[model samples]
Target: MATPPYPPPPPYVPQPPANRLGGKHKTVLGCGGLLFTFVLIGAIGSACSPTGSETTKKVPGPAVTVTVTATATVTPAANAAAGSPKRAQESAPAPAASAEPVTAKARLSNHVGQQLQAAQDAAQAEGFLVLTSHDATGGNRMQVWDRNWKVCSQSPGPGTLDTATTIDFGAVKLEEACP
Candidate 1:
């Protein structure tokens, strides 16, 4: 028996080009790289953002005009008689005297005593109607209450003020309680 005349050459298998990349693999890799870049940029922006001591620009406000107009009006007697403001119908009357403001002076006994009369007088003098007067033991002075009170001046010196008008003189605690 003799060998075949032509020995078959090794099978011719074709190889793909080296530089070619898969379409799906390239798309996925590019997209992943783009997403990573975007995420990195976003993180950097957030970190540098004005998280502390942030400031805002103030927008200019619209211009405004203040136009003042008198609201007073004059009416006839007939209208006033029909239950209008009496001031409109009556002849202009003389200006009434201005009442003086109320004032008061008081002395606390031994820093704690109920000598409220002095306070009352001072309040009357200053044109204030005394409502209630009491000893402010916690405040170490006398406190007088009224509709409106103010201490024009104290007799001795700088004293504690309870209200705009009411004040406390120097406190002197008595050895014995007042009768």
Candidate 2:
């Protein structure tokens, strides 16, 4: 048997110091580069701050001006009464009168037609206004009165004296037909 020959080894080439950065040196250089970048950014920011010139100053915002004026012409005291009506004077508001119903000496019980008259008389005596009177039901008439003897509202409600008390003297009327 013949012996086979072995192949020769390939030639070897030496590598140069391919790495430019060493471990600690690389860390220091990276830190220095970062510091330089930060300083450059800070310088740019300082340059961009307002310089009080038209281009560096902020644009003027919308200018606004507001003015208000009021004028009043005073009327004389005597002339003020000319526009108001006579009735308005009569109806001049009074202090809220005692809400407690006024007591009547005459009992309104069994008094239908006479209810209005009784209310009117009671109101007159009490110094209230008697506006008008009309029949509300059989034996019942309502009378209306203002704070003064001025009639305001009336109806013929023939219930009783107690019932009429609540009617505020305004529902008593002196009419023949019941409303």
Task: For each of the candidates, give the backbone clash count.
Answer: 17, 21
Write model 2 residue lDDT over 1-179, tens digit each, in one string: 86559777789988787887779999998999999999999999878854322221112222223334444443334534677665555555543433443433322222223343444555343333323443324345322331112223344343323222433333322222334
RMSD of candidate 2 to true structure, Å: 36.1
**Candidate 2 versus the native: TM-score?**
0.24
Give the lDDT of residue 84 in candidate 2: 61
The C-alpha local distance difference test score for the whole of candidate 1 amounts to 0.42
What TM-score goes with each of the models?
0.21, 0.24
Residue 83 lDDT in candidate 2: 78
What tens digits encode model 1's per-residue C-alpha lDDT throughout 1-179? 98999988999889986967789889999999999999999999878754333222222322223333434443355555666576554754444544454433332212122223444454443333323432223343443332122222233233332234434433222222332
Q: lDDT of each structure?
A: 0.42, 0.42
Error of 1 at 90 (Å): 71
Q: What 10-residue stretch in candidate 2 is worst by lDDT?
A: 52-61
